[model samples]
Target: MVDNRYTITVGTEQFRFTRDQLESDPGNYFATYFFGEFTEASQGARELVIEKDIQLFRLIQAHLRGYDIFPLPDAAVPPYMTKEVAIKNLRHDAQFYCLGKLEGTIKDLEQTSVKKEVKNGGKSPLARRYKAGECVISSYLQTWTFQEINNDGYQLMLDKLKNIDIAIPSRRPQVPGFSVTFCWVKENYYYALLVSDD
Candidate 1:
């Protein structure tokens, strides 16, 4: 028997599916067609990304259609936090987000310093943990210019300081919009470029 347990949230609506439902005709067709199109697409260097997104989309759809794709709770889940609330919480909780020009400068420099310590066997345990290549997420608020400066300087500084593993190197799009760019400073402290077209 195919296990098709999964959860899906569309806007404010949440739905769950069992394995049997996921394996049902409609669910399978949706999964197959969507993934088939994704796989057949001419992806140059972005094949992996395309595949990953397709898989995620399929899983979500499967869950929505009552497939047991994942072992989820039967209880009603809480509503998702609003985007503004989520962003606000992230800023409050993240260790690396800076508020002003001086804060941005100091944060980046401090992270760079930590990177140096990890390389030379310094005292920060967090730095050592980071040098080993772990996934981290942080949020911050800063002026657009500071964000740009951080983005420009990020890769060069990482190469100079750590000589350690870096995952998913920073990418800057040609499009105009607001987005955050993440980079390793030293070990624990990170430099984030918060851009806005406003």
Candidate 2:
């Protein structure tokens, strides 16, 4: 009987996976390459060779083998890379491999990370980009619009706010510290009008 084990050569590193494992996720890069019309046998190939980052590939393999791929424990992250870098790298490889599950997991990690960062007083992308003297408008905005986010207040905002985006606004230099010009609650939701004097 022919061996069903498949050898995957990624760069100079070599890893082995069973045929069933490689074909588990149909339509993914591996399944498409191995079982699609361009079968390895057609080219007399002994093993699958992928010219990609081996570190990312290793993480992908771990994920495929039922490992929780996101929010990796401290022990799992190498000394050379931070947890954030690992997540980003995995996100990149997951997209390239067309792994939907991994992609979804990464998104969840991102949201969780954002929440954690905010809870720990880390500045958000919105906070970093927003400037004094500029108006931020949202039709579906909330009362938390320009309210100062005390540690306790952030929990309330994070729980109630599903999404936020900046609509049309006047020009202002990007600066920290702003105030809410107007705020109101509408149908269990909140809206805000923010303006500041720089």
Please report, in order, the local distance difference test score of every candidate based on alpha carbons: 0.36, 0.59
Output the number of the lDDT-best candidate.
2
Model 2 C-alpha RMSD to native? 14.0
Which candidate number would show the highest TM-score if scored against the true structure? 2
Candidate 1 residue 41 Cα shift, in angstroms, is: 15
Backbone-clash count (model 2): 6
Against the true structure, candidate 2 has what lDDT?
Answer: 0.59
RMSD of each: 20.6, 14.0
Tens digits of per-residue lDDT, candidate 1, 15-98, equal: 455444434433233233333344532331111222212323443444335454322232221223322223223333222212
| Per-residue lDDT of model 2, residues 114-162, tens digit only | 8987898876543432211222335653222233333323333433444
What local lDDT score does residue 98 receive in model 1, on the 0 to 100 scale? 23
